[model samples]
Structures are given as structure tokens and as C-alpha cells.
Target: MAGIVIVGAGECGTRAAFAARDAGYDGAILLIAGEAGLPYDRTKLTKPIVPGEAPFGGLSALRKPICHANQLDAAGITLLAGTPVGKVNSDARQVTLTDGRVFGYDRLLLAVGATARRLACRGGDRALGFRTIDHAQTVFAKARGKVVIAGAGLIGLELAAVLSGQGAEVTLVEAEALPLSRTVPAGLAERLMARHQAEGVRLLCGSEIEKVTPGFVTLSNGKRLPAPSLIAAIGVVPNTTLGAMAGAMIDNGICVDAQMRTSVPGIYAAGDCANVTLPNGQRVRSETWRCAMAQGIVAGQVMAGQTASYDDPNWLWSDQYDLTVQVVGQVADRPDALRQLPEAELQFSIDSDGALIGVAGIGRAAAMTKDIILAQRLIRAGAKVTARALSDPAIDLKSLLRTQGDV
Candidate 1:
């Protein structure tokens, strides 16, 4: 049977298969993956890998397979693991695997995801790129001494926090003046930087890696640091080769519409491999798990002839040391206005129409959790709220919503 063929059996691909089944499409569903094992949560690779711990370890760990064999069988999902697709023939609706196998598809979903970007400095190969579970394991096994990390983005900072927690001295290098300069507000970034410094993670902002040697890394700022282990969490490049080769439009990622439909009609793209157009005609790709899952589900629903569109605001969270940092919506672009809730350790970005457009918080887990949920609601609804109400911890967000009849 010519079935729905999905490439890249990560969160997006697996979820798309399940979503298609759940939406009542019972035809043959083929899930293809380059990795050997079942689909696991890629987000958990940065977390502390604790062996034998429940939920976070063993089969229940985020690193463990999210989709088991029995589950796949029960769902009637056929999985081809450890097999990479070499090219996609959009016109013929066929996929060619690296091992010379070919599969025809009525509809195709490209969820190939992304790979970590590597640095080009001398001896850069000595530094490992932290993206996969294997990379995490290798770093954990070799993290006995001082470790230097390139880039001060989420991955770099997260690894720093995890390694430092395990008693390894960590140093983070970033060419930007502040860590997460493009994602979080300056105030929140400052707080995070302070938290890392307090926990003994050295920050080398506005510094570049001049050269990397077997035993050390020299900074452009003329500082030489000991580096028993060097890691690069620079960024990621979307895996758009197959889609591009198949004649799908490619920009920052595989360009897709709100329905996750690619330039090619029978083809769709989701997850990290898909770049979605926003309400303002802006094309962007969200590499977060939440965005990927949403896109995949929507793509599946659309493929099943159901009405669906992915319009959720961008959301992502990071657990660094004792702090749980959550950011939602577009805070990178300067908002029309900004408000700070110092007591609550929160910042809200207001658009020109006085709508809550973004929120960033770093504090006690429970409090931040509550604030994040409320912030998401307000941002999603585009609620026009006063800065005073948002800045006051005494005022409950629910009450404000009720007062405005937005609930």
C-alpha cells in the first residue's frame, strides 16, 4: 500500500505518525529514522543523565524511547530504524534509502530535524559537539577535569550547569556581549549569567576562541584556559538536504505554510526541518520540542483532510542549576513597551497595542510555573493588560483576565 511515509523518526516524525492514526487514517504508516533505536526525547539530552533513577533514568528517562515496540505495533506503525533516506523524489512520490531500498508514498512528511554546528578554530575537532545522547554520554564519561564550552547559548549554558553540578570546572565562551543576547531580555540574561557565576561557571562573554589545542583553549582576548574537555554548543543547522534535493523551497529551513505543507503539494515538513510563516509573513523555524510537536500534529491532521493550523506562540524552557527559566513569545525584537516585576523576578513585554507579547522568568519553580502559564495565556490571547497589573505580584493574573472578561 502506498502509505504516509515520514522521514526522520524523531519527536516530529513519530508524533506525526501517531497523530495521523489518531485522526482515523488507518492505511499503512511508515516511520523512517536514521537512528537505530526508537524515538526518544531529544530535549532530555542536556539534562543530567542519572542511571537507575525513576522517570529520569532507565526506560523512563527522557533519553529512553518514547515509542516502544508494542506501542508501534498496536498503532499499526511500521518503523524502519537505523536507515537514512538518501534522497526524496517528490514527483514520483518515492523515497530512496541509503541502503538501496525504495518506498513509495501517497503523502510524505519531512521531519529530518537538525545537527549541531561546529566551530572552525584550530584543534576544534578536539571539542565535541553536544547534540545527541551519545554526545552527552561521551561528555559525562570524560568530564573529570576542567571543561571549556564554546558559545553561551542555551545548550552551552545548560551543559555548563550540568557539568559544574557534577564537580567539573566549566568555562563558557561567547562572542556576544551577553549570553542568550538574541533570545532573552538583557535583565533576565544578566540574572542567568549571575546564577552561573555564583555556581562557579566561568563566563567569557564578548570573547572568541582564538585556537583550541589538545590541552588548552586560547581566547581572542588573550586569555589561555585549561581544557581537559572542550565542547561546542554553538548552534544547529537544519537538515534540509533531502527536502531541498526534492525541490521543496528551502530558506532558513524547509519552508512550509500554516498547514505545514511544503512547496511540493504532496509533501509536508515539520519540526526543526520546517520553517513556518507567521501571521506577519515572517518565516521562522522553532527548534523547541513543543513547537515541533505542535507542527507535527497539525501537519498530520491536515494530511488526514482535517482542518488544523499551527499558530501557537513560541515557547521554550531551560533548567539551569536551581533555576527554571521559561521564555514565551517574541522577546528578541524590542517590544513597544517593557515592564519588570522585580519582586516576582519576571519581565513582561508589551506590544504597541498594550498586549502582553512576551514573558521571561527565572525563579522558584512553582512560582515561575504559575507565572509562565498565565503569561502564555495572556500572550496567546493578545490580552490588552495594564503594566501595573502585570508588575504587581499581589494581583492575580486570573483576576485580571476575569475583570477584562478574557477568561
Candidate 2:
């Protein structure tokens, strides 16, 4: 009866199951996932899961041999794939599956993940947002020449790079003036725009799709483009309906506290579907793989009667072409507070106190720099983010390290 049940066998649920076993919780751990096959990295879908690509030739999209689910199974976790939870009766301590089976659990973890958000424009239903493996495969199979993608979000830009790099004429339309405006500043967005343009991908900022017809799309500027495929990377909505059905508090995502504990006792939520506020006063439902895994570990540890708190310095990365962009901690909530570093190399998000809240870098730097940023923030210390400090050419890093008190 002390067993833990995890819903949604993505990175979050799988990590919780593995972590539970690794932590010596020798009880029945059940992972219920809607996806039929093994859990693969969803971020890699835009890059490798597209059909007809060299990487998508075989079952390699699932990372054959050393797969996500396989690794979980190796840790003695029971996985129930292709079976989704239909309803949760938290009061009665039971979960009903779509097939009319009920399972009881002492502790439950909600890692249901999220679904891609759809635009409310005309003919929007005809568009597809990449959220699952099947969707990516279907989109890639149907994609041929000239694809019109709406939205300049991470998913849209990543897919544009993949399709365009593979010889498809890609036209990416964004309503915002810059790409990734909500996440990155204008300078980073402009640089990303330049990279996409250099690779022959058409960028349309401050543009909207007026209408969509078969094999063609009409733009707001009275321009009609021909394309057989359309991808809408607008945003994502958390999979919180099940939690709501069970009478759990729901916000943009399932609202949780610093401990990943839901409003209801014995029930917890984590991953992209759970909206959590960090110690630094930043609230975000991060969709990054690392956040999901780390949250899962924390949830699992808590479910197994551990007192540890989930205080992760959130980080995310996107791999497009040869560029690897890494973001650490929460950027300044205010747009104007973000300052760009010299050579357009890095950007710092400073709080009202002028303490660094986050750091985002464009070019490669020492891996330790990223680790230090995360480690310091995880301990709730000053971010130490300064433009002159990072840009000084003559400053020795060793001396700078000596100045800081024990981290």
C-alpha cells in the first residue's frame, strides 16, 4: 500500500519510477503512459523523428537499445504503456483506466505532460502542433516542398531548421517582432533570425495568416504562399484535466508548491504540467527535459518519505544546426531589465537589487561557468551577474573565485 503510482510515462514519470527504485523503495511502482512505444526525448523529435531523414530510418528515433523505458525497466519499474488514466478518484484512492481497470495507490505523482496549443485563427484545425512522436512522424511523411509554419516559438524555429536544412523551402511566420520574444531578448532573437535566413529559411516577423486553403496559405499582408504542410508552434497547455476531474487545484498548469505537493494530500505534480514557483520568486512551468527529470526525482524522493525540497535552478537548451543555446535560472521578469553583453555573446537578467537572476549565452564558454551559475542559484545565493564582470578581458577567473565566500 506504500507503493507510488505515476501517470504519463514521459521523462517525468519514468524518472520518478527509476528514482523510486534507486532510492531503495522496494514497493510496487506503476507507470501509466499513453504513448504505446518507449519514452524518447521529445525535444529531439523536431530534429530526428521526421520521416525520410537519415536519423529516422529505423526505430532509432526511440534510441534503440538504451531507450528511456528500457532504462527504467532495468531499475525494476513496471511500465504500463498505451494505457491512459481515464479518471482519478483521489478521495477513494483509486485510478480508473480507459479499459475499466482500477488501481489503488498510497502516493501518486502527476506527470501527465502537456499538449501543443492550437491557434484560434481560421482553418486552424487543419494545422498540426508537434507534441507526440506520432504527430512528428505523420507531419514529416506528409511534408514535401515548401512548408509554411506559423509562430516563431522554439518548436516552430527548431522544426523550420530541420525541414529547411533537409532541402524544404520553409517560411516561418511570427506575430511577434522577434523570434522567442517571451524567452530571449531581441538581440538573441535577431541572431537566431539571421541564422535561419542564412540557411535559406524565410522569416516573416509581425505577420499573420489570414486564411488557409488546401495546398496554400493566405497571409495578412495579402501574400499567398503555397505549401502542403503547416505546423503551428504557438504554445502548450498542461494536461491537467484529469487532475481537475479529481478536484485538484489547476492554474495554467497544476499548481504546486516548492515541495511539488499538490493541494490534496498524498497527491503530487511535477514536470511541464505542474506550475511551480522557485525560491527566487519566479513562477514557470518549464517544458525542459532536465527540469522534468529533476522534478521527478524530487517528487519520487518525497513520495518515498524523504524530507528533501525541490529547489532546482532551471535550465533549458535548443539545438538547431550547429548552434547549442543554453539558458540558466529565471531571466528578469521585466523586459527592460535584461542587458546584452559585449560582442552579442551573452545576456544577463538582473533583479531590482541588481543581483543577477539569470544568464543566457550564445557562443560556447567553459562548462564550469554554466555549472557555477546553476550551483550558486540552487543554493539561493546572489546570481553575481554583471556585464562588466563577465566582459573584462584582463580579469583572471582564479582571482574572481577567491573573492567569493564559501558557496
Candidate 3:
């Protein structure tokens, strides 16, 4: 029986395959992969730069299998690697491969992830994109020389950190005045900016690119920078061709309800290609690794005749030169409160009712991670924490959480 079919076997697709089994769906599952080779964790692509290694294993070394043969076999998931889907016929509940292979499904999950947004400036095509493993291979091959990177967002900054650690002369240019303005709080951005500069990263915020040649970049101000290798980590555009062709509603992305069901019945989407629509008509754009996993679980469980919905707070972490930054709850960089610790600094976003909505922390990896997790739990429980209490290092957050009746 053609039980369930999942397109685009990234983390979301692969996880959903297993999640269906965990949800007790005893049926056939087909997972179509766009890229060949085993599905690996995409988050490890630009993290923890390895200094001067032989034959280049920095990326491959971090290839944690999303689903191995043993796991797939045990979970009873059929994985078709390197398959390009030609068309998704929702009316017929079928997915057709470019090679003309047809597979029908009781339910379909489209996790066709996003592609790197390219630069629109003149000669911008010269810059390489950093997305999949193939994209990283090209960038990593030339990272030993002078490199120019556009955009100071998370992707750009992380790439800069990795390349700079490898002794490359790196320049990071962003259109915004500050890096990570949207995801990171202002205070953390300042600290991160300083760290990047100290580590020999030429960060040029509030900058624009005029043109990019094969080996050089010209800024709007006529500053020509040497670029033996150039990369664009600007952002991503949702890959919604198949979903749209299948007649699903598309807004900022393929619109999915709380349970990850698309507007079309028996169809759903998750991961980077999905925008979770709320009851109030707002869409939540969650594109991180954890977010993908969460959405996959929701989609799979709901598809397997179980009830589930994705309403969790979004959280993500970034690693750069021994410093790890994590944010949860209210993502606004401008926080309503601040807490300064020796090992880490916490920025808090509190609601008007005095409930802690968000928190951003940066410092030592160990300290930052612990505090962030605690803050996430508190925020999830809608803890009405005050600035005064959060400000005092003496007042333990765990104690405060206990008062709210959460373990």
C-alpha cells in the first residue's frame, strides 16, 4: 500500500518518516531526497572551524547522519536519494519524479527547503552561495585565500568565523548598521561585533555592494576589496514550486496550519519551506534546525491519525570562535531587562504584564547554554518574572521558576 510519501529528504522529511512510525503508523513510507548521499546535519556545515587540516575534513567530519541504513530499516522507511520530483499532483494524491517514476500516497509532506538568496548587484553572480554540502565544498576549497562575504546575518557571521579561524583574510559586509539585528539583541550584537573585529574579521556594516568580479569586490563608496573568493549568505527563498503547482496556498511560504496541514487536505509542509499560520492570521517563520525537527513531528503525528500542533517558542544557537550565542522567547535584540554575569550576559524581553517573553545570552559556551535553557522553560510557562528579580544575580531563576509551580 502507498501509505505516506515525503518529498525533499532534509532533516524535516527524514525526521517525519521516523516520527510517523513512532506515532504507530504501520504502513509503507517513501522519502525522496533531492541530493544524493546520506542526509547529514546541515547545521554542522559552517560551525567550529578546524584549523589547517589535511585533505579537508572539517565539513565531512561533522556529517552526523540524519538517518542511517539501520535506522531506516528498523523504522521501515524507504529512502530514495538523489531523486528530483517532477510534479506533485495533489488532486490524484501522487508524486511524479522527473525520471517519470510515479508514486501515489495517502498523505504527502513537502519539505522542499529554501535555496540561498543570491545577490542582485552587478556581477553578483560571481559570488558563491553557502547552502548545501556541495555549496560549502566550493567555499571551503578557496577559504585559504582572501575572502569577501556579503551579509552579516547568522549565516554570513558563522561563515566568517569559520573562514577567519582558518587564517583567511575575511571581510564581512552587511547592509544593516549592526550584525544580527533581527535575531540578536542590540547589546549582544555589540559584543559579537567587537569579538569579530578582535579576531581579524573586517566587519563593514551599513555597507552596500556595487559589483563583484571574479577576484574583486567594489563597494558603493568605490572601495575595492580583494576577493580571491566571495560568498553570499544573505538569506534564503522558499522552494515552493512543487507545492504551488500542486495548488497549495502560498504566502511568505507554503502556508501550514498549527498541525502542519496545508490548505489542501491530505497535503502538508514543514521545515524552511513552511510558514505556520496561527489562529490570529499571523504566520511564524521558523527556519532553524530545531524548528524543523519540531514541525516534522507535528506534521507526522497529525498525518498518522494522531493529534498534534506546533506552538512552541522558537530558539536557535550560533557558535563562533569559542563563543556561543543563544536566543529564545522574544527574539527582539532590544530587551526590556539585562543581567550581567562573569561568564555570560543575559538580555531579557518582558511583556507589559511583567512576564518574561524572551532572553538572549552570549559568553562561555557552557554558561550561555545552561542559562538559555532555563530561560526558555520560564518563558514557555509564561513566568511573570520581574526585571528586578532577573537583574539580581542573587535571585536564582530556578527558584523563581519553582514559585511559578514548574519544575
TM-score per prediction, in order, is: 0.93, 0.88, 0.95
Evaluate all candidate structures by whole-model CA lDDT and list the values in order: 0.84, 0.75, 0.86
Q: Over the stretch 86-191, how does candidate 2's per-residue lDDT look in tens digits?
A: 9999888888899998889998899999988886777877887788877877777766577889998888988888878678888999998888888765666778
**Best-matching candidate per TM-score:** 3
Worst 10 residues of 1 by lDDT: 53-62
Give the C-alpha lDDT of model 2.
0.75
State which candidate, 1 or 2, has the greater TM-score.
1
Residue pairs with colliding backbones in model 3 are 185-333, 330-358
Question: lDDT at 262 for candidate 3?
Answer: 88
Q: Quantify how close model 3 is to the true structure by its C-alpha RMSD in Å.
A: 2.0
lDDT of 1 at 390: 80
Q: For model 1, what is the alpha-carbon lDDT of residue 299?
A: 82
Q: For each predicted model, how many residue pairs clash, with residues at least 3 apart or on different chains? A: 0, 0, 2
Minimum summed lDDT over a 10-residue window in model 3 is located at 52-61
Worst 10 residues of 2 by lDDT: 57-66
CA-only RMSD, every prediction = 3.2, 3.6, 2.0
Model 2 misplaced stretches (Cα beyond 4 Å): 49-70, 279-281, 332-344, 364-380, 383-386, 393-402
Where is model 1 more than 4 Å wrong at Cα?
51-62, 332-344, 403-407
lDDT of 2 at 224: 88
Between candidates 2 and 3, name the one with more favorable TM-score.
3
